[model samples]
Target: MHRSPTAEAEVAEELAEARPDLVSRYAAELPGARAAVLTRLWRALAYEPLPWVAARVTDGDGLSLRLVDGRRLDGPPADPYATAAYVTDVRLDGRTYDDPARLMTDLGVPHSSDLAAELGHSVASLALSRAGQPTVPPKEGPGADWEWEQRVVDGHPFHPNCRSRPGFSVTEQLAYGPEHRPLVGLRTVPVPAAECLVSGGWPEGMRDGERLLIPVHPWQAAHVLKRVGDEGPVAHPLMSLRTLALSGEGPHVKTALSARLTSSVRDISVYSIGVSATLSAFAESLASRTDGLLHFTRTLGAVTADSPDLAAVLRESPQTYAGSGERVVPVAALATTDLPSSAAWLAEFTRLALTVGLRLLDLGVALEAHGQNLLVVLSATGAPLRLVYRD
Candidate 1:
């Protein structure tokens, strides 16, 4: 039996036709990308509470997993936080497997095939993302905050499906992916005010008389909505692909994108829209007790056409919290800078983050301080200053 083409092969075929110039570069990036994804998968197997992983054994040879099916999966010791592509391959039942998708397929666990497909896409898309990055890392900080977001080419550091944009074609990935740094033109769907549930103050620029102009992601407009409106703001895509940063220090616009990205389909539900204002106010009040150590970007507005498929949320940019000579950077983009390598700096950042986090928790609030939602304000000397959290 002949096996189907892997996602990398499929992407290569697409690039060969649409952009032959990128074919060689994409191919060159595959080995590193594969190892990067394999490292994440190994981490998951070593630590995640998966039912099939019967037991974990560690010996002088490194880490080993005994599956419920009585097969052994072996690899190097997993470091959950390490970003380097240290994992080249792993042994599954005496057979060596380099590709994560292939290894998962041969493992033959329940739902492994579905995971295998996503892993394939993840490797391919990750390579494509790497191929588009600049050859040398930037020596200085970016002119705008959104540029720091684009620097995170590898997406989620721990997820195996970090770059698995299943519905996005190579062309679409290049055109819309934040790593590619494309200018995405947003569209606004007109919905009558009476038919919409709105919270906070909707921008007058987005109001069409009595109708609310809902911002829509181009991908969502084409694939889900099946209707496009007149050209709206041409903005920079942020770390969260559904959200975009408007030009010249404007708010970040979050659109309802109904496609599965990594784990879930990102769509603004009516319940969330209805509670936006209350939640924002509550979060703000909680943040106020932090005494200048923490900040929450306010949700400027939220609206929905009574459907998850058509909703929008406008929020103030986290950069708004940055004073002159300071930089507010998403935690995910910290790898692009040398700050993380400094033990002293990391300690300071840890203390500040824990201080705010513990303070909030003591006051009856637990923040989602994940890489994407959390940011650090760095002084002109690159010292950690404070923390910023947003959804």
Candidate 2:
């Protein structure tokens, strides 16, 4: 396997030539980004079941981890939910270090090298993400749900590789990253209707006579399929970069993006398409048992050309569940709004989410209710009312 330059080096090189004006800002935000990523890494070390960690010890000196390699790592008391960059440094084997990547490298654990590289990318990408944002968030949250999604500058809250987009260049990140707020113009590849295995109703607009047009993310087109196709609708990239919110309030398009983001390569598998209709029906049936407390966005349609590299899934947006004067917000974007500050509001939201989640769990269906998949419907007064879950 070949290795590329460090993420910070790559970003610096790109910005020096193409975005010189942002060079200083990106540099300024690096420290905070490092701290942010370090915080997540610390939390994972303290809690997650990593095989390399043989034992965990916590006492007056904060948290300590004894690695399987006979080395010990120490850090400040970990707060699983703290968003602030309170962790600036930690001690590993009596040596003080600040960079999460460097610390991982020094640990010399199995696959630590790969994880270290991702941690480095996470730090650099996170800095770039923060540099692109306004210093202060808007006093009033945007009306559109997509706008709220963009406000989540950082990616996964707990993953060490939160902002690590392994294959995306800085240019591509700025162009397709939701936090950058770019209008992504999607393209469509027409496949013979006979060759496609489709579930539900494939829209007429996405068809040309006997061919079904599959929406393709630009990244996938240039890098994976290596062929350009007809232009489709322009859309806003949501939290999941492969999924986009189409113009004219159309269904959200989940295109095949064969890039490694965080943990996995995001490609729409054919197996998923094969079972999409059944899964959607099952989810709908389960949602009906919630008595209006929970809703699952219907998977409108799914099509695959017998390849994970070329597939698409169209689903009703969570916004469709919001009634008049109410707004549907992804749980990830809740931090951008003022509702989380209120003790009463947090309690209410927690109660609503747990009720729906546990109810479905009792029925033997466990939902991946992560911040991105779980959404909340807020009343006019910013009170969390109902819960929405989607794939």
Candidate 3:
């Protein structure tokens, strides 16, 4: 059931009494939050390959889909790739459903209740992101590479949990969400050298008195690792919130963040820790055959407390490829910026991405070359220079 505006204010007031800080934020976030939920629900209805969607077609004004129960659903034209907002309500069998959660409940689909809760959280998170000042990078101005990555205010293009952060609090999201552009103070834990399984080369600076100091994400340190020591290094959070650029240079530290962000909970697997170095070396060898168009960020080091919940991987930042006056932008964020929407530029970027992706596949590695994992090194004038692939 959708909460009325008065009901929403009452709830906010109740929360504000305990938090105090939430009073202003709650009011500021509500409108954006509702719109986010509507967008997510619309995405799920339009796409998602649901069994209930018997057939789908498009018309002049919008889209039309037939349900298994012979109910007709209609809405505005859906552009899954575009981040622009869409109408919040859709007509279901000539009846309008104002909220997506209510629509799902009426549809009686499996896992409807659970999904409704997740959708609610997604709305709240999106509202928080939209309420804050968006961090956009200048077209050709001097800015850190991370700043460009952080400019992706919208979360995912198609998934319903685009901005869903189920386990993160509002304060945590403001401090660590990549869109917030927060410089996180990473803490390190001293694990006995023999007790830790390591891959690749651990930095000498991470060692102290016969112990290997393993970096932990602050969130993980508080909720998962729970053995945080001194504040080790300051880092900027990347598009992937789990990974942080050590001062936007050198290597990125991917720490375990045990929460449902976007679609799923991301944690460093024990298996990945075991083979990080080998995989990095293998990827490097394959990248050499791409004729310098591809650069695989090497896994500099990986350490685990013999637990998937407590792990860290030090990865080379993709910024290494960009020379002076060149810019490295994540493909997802690039879509948000003005990158000269010319046929030549699009064709060039497509060719470069496909060439590198296919080359690696021929060499026995299939890259998950989605927008998030794929990046482009662009010339000052927006010419596609090279491709950077990361997991």
Candidate 4:
């Protein structure tokens, strides 16, 4: 039972909305595929306590009715794919209804209720699916699920949790949406150099050495305590992988965050309520959706925010040392000409740096956000997904 193109586009737009990074990264693989992704995501929720959602219909034959969510209506259709092809147009499960009861019979609430009504729920019970990863491994195969205590939620408005939520029921948090992050594993920073932030320590890892201004703002740092409590690697393996190039006109960003919250909310911003308050405000809304799903990230300089970029280089690029009182004008990293900045393909490099800086902002965790603080792994080209941490 496919819906109308407008309806499907709306759903895809919802899923692909806030996280500009996701759009930037995976737009290529999304348009033509989604039904199976939706099926896998919803089927996994069969016995869980996640919220009810409107299933997007995707089929082309007579009553190829699967539930719009995962369980479609068992009925007849004009030609199967004809009457309701909208669900696949944008490639999402119908449109998003904030009300769980309307999306699922289990919620059992009338659809006419205030659309803005807020609900609280946990993420543990929600179904997890690869909405659009290209290389989705078998659900039962090795590394089938990301297997983190965390799972993305499904809701009308996505809200990714900036803070950790321990000992919370997944079902109870579903209504709150993605704003509630499931902190089962340790989220470590990937910094390998000694810096002012962690005194040369890894941003999220345990201390290792000494550095100045190593201060990690409470806003940018996700969590630095304890290793992964599970059997997986101490940190997410994805961080160890290389990042992809920005093939888009700019950086390709795919993340889950509030569009309104995209700007820096640190003490520096006029609109910022400080890191804690900004996070709290986000949490309040997150608690409302608790769908364990809010994926939004933005791109900067339309590419990456790295030292090589003109904007980033000029603002934060390292300066070369010159003899004192020699009337010598300070030289720049590229100007030092030790390496070919020209060979660096300066244009592409700038775009890459901007992309990284912007995504980290969307994540709302502490970060130097400069080129030096970022990591770029060369591996991970065809994988379905991978974790990214700024050391």
Maximum-TM-score candidate? 1
Model 2 Cα lDDT, one tens digit per residue, 292-386: 99999999999999999999999999999999999999999888767789999999998998898899889998889999999999998988889
Show how many residue pairs clash in every candidate, following the order shown.
0, 0, 0, 89
TM-score of each: 0.97, 0.96, 0.88, 0.20
**Least well predicted 10-residue stretch by lDDT in candidate 4:** 310-319
List candidate 4 segments past 4 Å from native.
4-32, 50-196, 199-391
By TM-score rank, best first, the candidates go 1, 2, 3, 4
Q: lDDT rank, highest first?
A: 1, 2, 3, 4
Superior by TM-score: candidate 3 or candidate 4:
3
lDDT at residue 156 of model 4 (Cα atoms): 17
lDDT of 3 by residue, 72-125 (tens): 889888777655556667788888765655666667778887776666666666
Backbone collision tally, model 4: 89
* lDDT (0 to 1) per candidate: 0.90, 0.89, 0.78, 0.24
Error of 2 at 9 (Å): 1.5
Q: Write the per-residue lDDT of candidate 1 for residues 8-119, one digit (tens) a residue.
A: 9999998888778889999999988889999999998999999999999999888999999899999998787787888888998888888999988998889999999999
lDDT of candidate 4 over 171-267, digit per residue (tens): 2222222223322221222332332111011222222343111112111222222222222112111110111111212221111111122112111
Which parts of model 1 are misplaced by more than 4 Å?
Answer: 1-4
Q: Which window of 10 residues has the lowest lDDT sum in candidate 2?
A: 1-10
Judge candidate 1 at residue 300 and give its lDDT. Answer: 96
> Best candidate per lDDT, number?
1
After superposition, which runs of candidate 2 have C-alpha atoms over 4 Å from their true positions? 1-5
Model 1 error, position 381 (Å):
1.1
